[model samples]
Target: MTYRGRFAPTPSGDLHRGSLLTAVASYLDARQADGAWHLRIDDIDPPREVPGAADRIQQQLAAHALHWDGSVQYQSQRHDAYAAAVDMLLASGHAFYCALSRRQLADLGGRHPGPAVAVSPASHSATNTNPNPNTDCAIRLAVPDTPICFTDRLQGRQCLSLGEADGAFVIRRRDKLYAYQLACALDDADQGMTHILRGADLMDSTLRQVHVLDCLGRTRPDYGHLPVLTDSDGNKLSKSAGAAALSPDTSANLYGALRLLALDPPADLAGAPCAEQLAWAIPQWQPARLNNTLTFGVADAP
Candidate 1:
């Protein structure tokens, strides 16, 4: 299959150094392979989206000469697609309705401890269960007991087992919103994405997405996770963490992002135009050079 990659960003805020680094890395990977690079606005959660975050993200990418190959896709407009996928999973018994509230799950934490938690199958098969649920109820995937393993292009071999007590992972929230795992898997398949280059912070999400792909009988793309940019306190730079918005100094921003990616761009290119710097750096882009190290102090970029 032809190489097809994407840079998917949640439109919670403007692009910061961390996000810029991901965009640059993904862009280079696609361009270096002479493949198609697509941009996806993950705007599924309206409560987290900013008014102009999506447009600003596009503008920032343009400023850095990171132009995508096709029209941008917004997750918000594809609710019907997500709904259909959920329905298919439900009908096939790959997923089930979840009436347990967040507080209820928290209360069951002592009974089910781990990074992954879910209600037991027996509990779901108990009396008063509603398989075909209403909007207020969440929908969870019935993950198999087998270990989910995949060789990450950057992080090396990775594995995780979803325990029986961990119950099920929600595919749809109680508020009637599709989960990231479900949406991302379906979207990648629908878009025919061949590869996924994103931040390492989402390493855990890979297993979940892979499971979703298996349930949907869709192909799983190759994944490469870049190092995540963090703050002084070692917290990952995120909109929730109040990462400052990126400045319009496209050249400096691109140079800084390249350095963070472990790409040694020429010092003289600091003052060069964004296009010139990208033109010089694209041929030199090396994803393997990144050592899976979290870059601290990225919020202090000049």
Candidate 2:
């Protein structure tokens, strides 16, 4: 299989130092393997999306010289594909309509119905037999009771039971918008992505996507998670947390990102051009240098 990888960013805000770190690491990994690196703008959730964030993200990447292969993919335009996958899962008995509201589920016990809350085909409401685009209930995958396990390249072995962790998780919302898990899983598999290297914060969502792929009978991708960059206060750097956006004018930020990855970039490369810095760092990319640490603080950058 071709070593295809991707950097998928949700366009809720501009790329921050933390996000730029992810982009750098992902780009290096794909380049080292002589693979194709793809960029995907995850803008499916309109309620959370910024008006011009998607285009700004592309410009930011271009400014950093982190060019991607092929035309950029936008999740907002893939509704038809998502709907078809949901329909297939429904028809094949892999997913079901869940009319239980959050309050209702919580009333059952917890905010989510645990492993014991498996819904049977006979339990489906009359409308479940033929749900339409206007269906009001959420669509959830009927996850198996077994634990989903996979070894991460950095975080090591991971095993989590989907049913116990999140129960029958939602793939489509009540408002007709497709859930992130569904679209993400489908896109990775459909795009022929063979390897995925992303932040540790998203590690938990991997199994959910794995299960989704299994239900759709698609090939699973190899997964790895880089350590998440935290702020001085130890909180994860995020747009919601008001993390500073990246400035592409200087390669100092890129060099700092390399150090954050534990690459220990040469002193001469500190203020060098982005292309020159990348030329030296690409072959020297060592993901294992993170030493399985889960968080890197802004203050810790040298």
lDDT of each: 0.82, 0.85
CA RMSD (A), model 2: 3.4
Worst 10 residues of 2 by lDDT: 119-128
State residue 251's C-alpha deviation in candidate 2, in Å.
Answer: 0.8
Query: What ranges in model 2 sit over 4 Å off?
Result: 111-135
lDDT of 2: 0.85
Q: Largest lDDT belongs to which candidate?
A: 2
C-alpha lDDT (0 to 100) for residue 210 of candidate 1: 92
Q: Which stretches of candidate 1 lie over 4 Å from their true place?
A: 110-128, 164-167, 292-302
Model 2, residue 235: C-alpha shift (Å): 1.5
Residue pairs with clashing backbones, model 2: none
Pull out the clashing pairs in model 1: 117-166, 118-166, 118-167, 119-167
Residue by residue across 1-302, what tens digits does model 1's lDDT show?
79999999999999988888889989888888889999999998899999999999999899888999979999999999999999999899888776665556667662223223333334532234453464356788876777888998887887877644364687899889999999999999999999999988888788889999999999989998877887778788898889988888888889898777667888899989988887887789877777555454645444
